[model samples]
Target: MKSYKKIAVVLTTLGVIGVSGCKKILDQSPKANVTPDVLASAGGVVGGITGVYSDLRNLWGTEGFLYYTNLGVDETLAGGGASNGGVAFATYKNYTNNVSDVYNALGGVFNIAYQDINTLNGVLQYGVAAFPDAPTRTAYLAQAKFLRALYYFHLVQTFGSVPLHTTFINTATLSDSRAPVADVYNQIIKDLTEASAELQNKPGENGSPFAGHAATKASALYLLSKAYLTRGWSSAAQSGDFQSALTTAQTLISTKATYGVDLYQNYADAYAPANDATNKEDLFAIEHSTDTKYGDFTPGASGGKINGWAYFFRPNYPTVNANYPASGGSGVMTRDIANGRPFFRVRPNYDYVNNVAFADRSNDYRYWNTFQTTWIANTANITTPRGSLTVGTDTAIWMPPYDPGADKRASFKGVIFLPPSVAAATTGANASTNTFFPALKKFDDPNRPSVNDPSSRPVVLFRFSEIYLIAAEAAYKLNDLTTAANMINVLRTRAAYRTTGMPANAVANMQITPAQVTLDFILDERTRELYGESLRWWDLTRTQSLIRRVKLYNAEAAPNIQDFMTLRPIPQTEINLVTQGPPIPQNPGF
Candidate 1:
């Protein structure tokens, strides 16, 4: 096995976070030795703590675990169409207990999590003593503790009863056992509560292009509140966890100005590529940059481009380099680098667009702001063999899955041939072959240095709107229906488009009453508000609604829905690597 000292040398050489113009938290000088004594210096402590954060970005950015967390939920489904056939990610869309694939797929999630936790453990043990001033030492320790808690939160949520490594045990040991779920949540709460007390309440310096990009009092508090809500629903939960969640959320709302966070008035502005720095809605986000040379935490990857989320959600159409007029028609469909290279990993469930989006709601800008239903061809020159000879007739590709009468092809006058239902628009004999589901255009990067590759859009980890939802849910759970309705109305009213009209987004007619504050209503509201935001699977799992929701919406995941499937199987490779003590057991079913 490789020595821990060797690993430390490599990590030190990598420097800390690659964010430019940020505070100098890393020591640039080459280190000959990285013992605990050497890390006792202030610079060393900063560098060590920054290294833990770098590990977090690497893990969250490219890790399959991040993708896995979004899979097989009610709101989203796998890419099962012809385009994404035979892909590795396509297989993971549905749940599987294949130990070997599970091991290989989540190696980064498991390994990097421990790597980050262990790094924080080192900083906690050695760095605290390194700082001479009490305030500085407390601040540094607070950041480390906050991050450690965040990482463990992900671990416990993904793989239940994960091994809790709180200290830096220099010597390798194989006897580590799985900590209880309640114990893991306890550690998370402890870390976040302690960190919130020490860290500044306001957002950090202009570290990246967005607010909430760094650890702060607000971020710690937000996560602590969420952790409490999660723990409150568990089998070994405490009595007042719900009350604690409600109180924390209430405190954040009342002190929003002190925290310098608020929901953006316009939903689209929150994700606009040009407005990241000005948007105050983001509570926590992973910062990426335009410079590829700064390097990435993930091994062998080199781009600051924001390709992962965009490409995964892009539409695979018009085969590469197929010019516009020849691809569809002049007025209908066209493809360009701006359209993105789609692998179709996560697509919207059929009903997500129809039943939820257009069922009765009107002027809900979220549907239009969050998704791309129309595609315009970038190129005009008909370079390839002009398959369908119609120029200037078809302009764009529109997949109105809800509109049964949408045209698949353009005729002489650009007339649409409407189908009777959504199934007719997407499937069977008359369905258009171009029936690629609506791509999540929120993360689309038109400013990427390279069009075909990834772009550097900051991944939002938490936003202020969620705090409202959290408060609402907590209040409802506590039987304070009035508070719950008021909390939810904030978002509902924000969603409204018209002051006085028949059909308006979240208008008075659309508002729910205190009696309507049910768990199902909250779930639906979350789905509408936070769709494709990487929080769905965990949300369902915590509520114990995974089986029911998946069965109701996803045909593919329903049959495989075993109760034990709620918790992921422990990767077998991890257990196999334990050469010294009792073996780690796999999750119940697998």
Candidate 2:
């Protein structure tokens, strides 16, 4: 039971020795400088393991990783604030593998992942001797293995075949080659299988060890199922991969009670800011806190460990009054913590939101639950063209799912935002622009210190609800339509509008028969349940639907996306760093 304070001190000490500015994976010399003698003690082993956890902050919550995972796919497009590096990801315009270009920023994941992998390798190598007690040693080693598997899973999924290093390097190496995708999957499965067997089953955020945010048996199982599911779609897929995935996911689903995780009854409650740290639906999350020392980055600092997920998908709501001058001086809306800082980096794809994902806005509560439709007036006595807005009582901005006719929209007191179709056709102040779409409410953090500060909320990386989706997907692949429909119905039923005036048969309306279980339907269901959560690109790629879906649903990216783009270009920096041997080749057609 080492205190978090002690671990933070060790993390700081290791951070100094391990920090490096080199962009290439092979050039991470500082990590190699971490001597084994430093990791040979029990306290050192704990610190080293905590360092691996800290590395996740660099990826899970950062803007670069967010763009890599969420943009240029069917679900999202470039928004008003996407003029920066993010627009390339969203539009796939001039997106290339060159290390000198903005796309190279995405390579941060590759570098940070290997850095953590090397650190984990050191932990596993020295942890046994550091902790002579068998149980303590096994617990520490299991967590390291789980993290290693997670890193490899992300790498393989993103870059196709990445250089695999399972041993700690004490010196920099000049030559490395990409492993076969099949080999990478094999290692991922092996590590997760071992981790799932050895790790404890405690729920997340329960005040257990590691501030109750440690990886558990459920986390390992979830990744294992995903690994199998992804591998089943890969060229290296085995005959039993889909069956293995289905069985593995079903095991976690059936035994969720023992794992101390379950889906929230209402989807909105799962993402409520107050429930963030202790949300039962979250199987694993990257922890962030207000404590500047251990909370990764300072809450409002320029850089470090801030979770910028709150910023990226938001629409520029504060500019709504500027965009429409009808709402007088005190403005109908102003920047507020509840509405989130408007980066407007990524906007939801119009077709995906309006036509595909939330087609049943009447029956599905997910449409309203997932988006912020109204902004309550925080300013006092704001006058609009139609009427006066009283503070806290009147709706200052309304972004309804459907287009209320011009006559109906003119009757509303506050500003009204129609769908992109109407906005695109309109002129002057109300004309189409990236800032006025429906703001995603899923990552909104009302608890931030100020309007512009980054969120301290732990990014929910894996959730219990995804387990059901994984099971449903695996069942669909296996042609077990009955099991697939059953698994999906559980989530759909939960997504139904449960309010009094909503349809009493909402749950029944949401339920689908086995005949309705197509690959496309499952993909749509995933968008309904997990859109803008940073899994869309992987989801689209894993199912080989990236090109087709992007063309159909994402007008901005459809013209430029190519088959070769399925696997992002292996960073050119990594290729350049191989000075001793033939340089690593870029992904085909890069």
The TM-score leader among the candidates is: 2
Per-model TM-score, in order, reads: 0.85, 0.91
In candidate 1, stretches whose alpha carbon ends up further than 4 angstroms from where it belongs are 1-34, 80-101, 205-212, 295-307, 320-337, 381-394, 404-435, 498-506
lDDT of 1 by residue, 392-439 (tens): 444334555454332434222222222234545444312222235678
Worst 10 residues of 2 by lDDT: 1-10
RMSD in angstroms between candidate 1 and the native structure over all alpha carbons: 4.8
Once superposed on the true structure, which residue ranges of model 2 sit more than 4 Å away at CA?
1-33, 97-101, 203-208, 322-330, 422-432, 497-499
lDDT of 2 by residue, 297-393 (tens): 5656544567888887787777666226554355567878888887887887776787788889888989888888798988876776678888788
The positional error of residue 103 in candidate 1, measured at the CA in angstroms, is 2.7
